[model samples]
Target: MNVPVVTGETTEKHPLEDYLRFDRLPHIWCPGCGLGTVLGAFLRGLLQSGLTPDKVAVVSGIGCTGRSAGYIKLDSFHTTHGRAIAFATGLKLAKPELKVVVFSGDGDLAAIGGNHLIHAGRRNIDLTVLCVNNFNYGMTGGQFGPTTPVAARSTTSRTGNIENPFNMSALAAASGATYVARWTAAQVHQMERSITEALLKRGFSFVEVISPCPTYYGRMNRLPTGLDQMRYYRSNSVVRHGTNPNEVGVGVDGQIVTGKFIDIERPYLPSSGDGNNGG
Candidate 1:
């Protein structure tokens, strides 16, 4: 099925519509892609936070997940591969009033972009990151990504993957994110809550979304459809917070841990710096 793309301007009813470049829609993403659900949660979060599109800047890296910024009605910037966070940092520092968001795939964030991710978390910059962890490099074919499970099958790992995956939320929290949370695409309501809080947060905020890669990850794993892919999260997922990552594992079905694991106040970057300029 072809994805539908609607081009239009922002009206009084859907004011944010103007920020989007709808001509790029009917995105190359596969049908029933979890990215769409993540996008919906993002919009709902913005509405709940009362954020006007003009005041928000959505940045994305290369990958199927990066396509998220294009579908949204906002000041969206599709940046170079693995550089969404770095670009967003500059944008936020230049215009303190605007909310900067980084959207990237698991590989874009955890592997190729790992350095940027850690630095952004360390500085506690005011930016919200929505990482869609599909576990493999879906857009470039089902190749093994850093987030791919140890035993998951991929094009590169015809038998099984041996590399360990990163627990993004925990990594962000330890690195210094003021807000950290994890949720699955199926948990839309909770995901919205996480995004809303992240947007309103003062310091670096990280949200790890467990998105299902049906066409790539699912097919390689022998799942029938995207709906079957969801079963992996529903059955194996413990839905427990603060549990030992080692203790929680995806069984034959797979388990997705979801919840607002952490939140804290931190100094905003704008408030810092030498007082000689204007003050």
Candidate 2:
């Protein structure tokens, strides 16, 4: 089957700047936070996807990254904490033609919203999820979350986090997402491609972006700036995809993996007009 191609008329702009609201300049994210980088990539992806602002819906949960929806000049909805996925599901089902994208933090999706995340994938909802995994919960004073590395210090875990982190791409793939990818903020070009493909995918699509929380996570981990943390990923990350869980456990400090882990076609939820399964 021919995948939905994303193209547009030629224009003399930054490609991404055309779709963004410049007046909304000076976003709320803390200085050195990688969420801005992720947002820039998303805008570029949307442009490459050939999705008009009116036809797309960007939803977000509560967090520093959740504030992303506000900056974008598109149809956006800021929902309750950890409920962005649930809200996006309903939006996609109600308007099957609309492209829905959920931007959230690791804690919002993996901790409080984990159940919803899995269920959405299992049901094969036609939606794209961009999960910015900064490891710690930066919005709430840098507490350890599901994506926080083991032995990492946080406000709650002053000594160190004893729990393991969740590999979001693997989790989504296991849960039945048709498209799953993992990338860091350092890989801006690759992340743009992942987001482009995810929006066009028929079933659940997830892209876990390893963004840097320089303000909190960085201060605790000794990486003072988001740029410094990005440099760490650039130098230490091991780019590969589809590796077994046992092989990539705990992501040793220096090895950050980046690639498209899964890209298999899956069934989307039945529309009311489609026959067979009652809608």
Best by TM-score: 2
Query: Count of backbone clashes for each model?
Result: 4, 0
lDDT of 1 by residue, 45-140 (tens): 877776755678899999999888878777889988889999998988887777888988898888888889989988988889999988889989
TM-scores across all candidates?
A: 0.87, 0.89
lDDT of 2 by residue, 1-279 (tens): 445354676344555675677788877788878888899899888777766567788999999988888888888888999999999988877877678899999899999999999999999888889999998888789988898888888898889889878878778888999888888899999999999888877788999898888888878887879888988989977778776533554442768778887888866784442211111
Among all candidates shown, the one with the greatest lDDT: 2
Which pairs clash in the backbone of model 2? none
Worst 10 residues of 2 by lDDT: 270-279
In angstroms, how far off is 184's CA in candidate 1?
Answer: 0.9
Summing lDDT over every window of 10 consecutive residues in candidate 1, give the lowest-scoring window: 270-279
Once all C-alphas are superposed, what RMSD does model 2 give against the true structure?
6.4
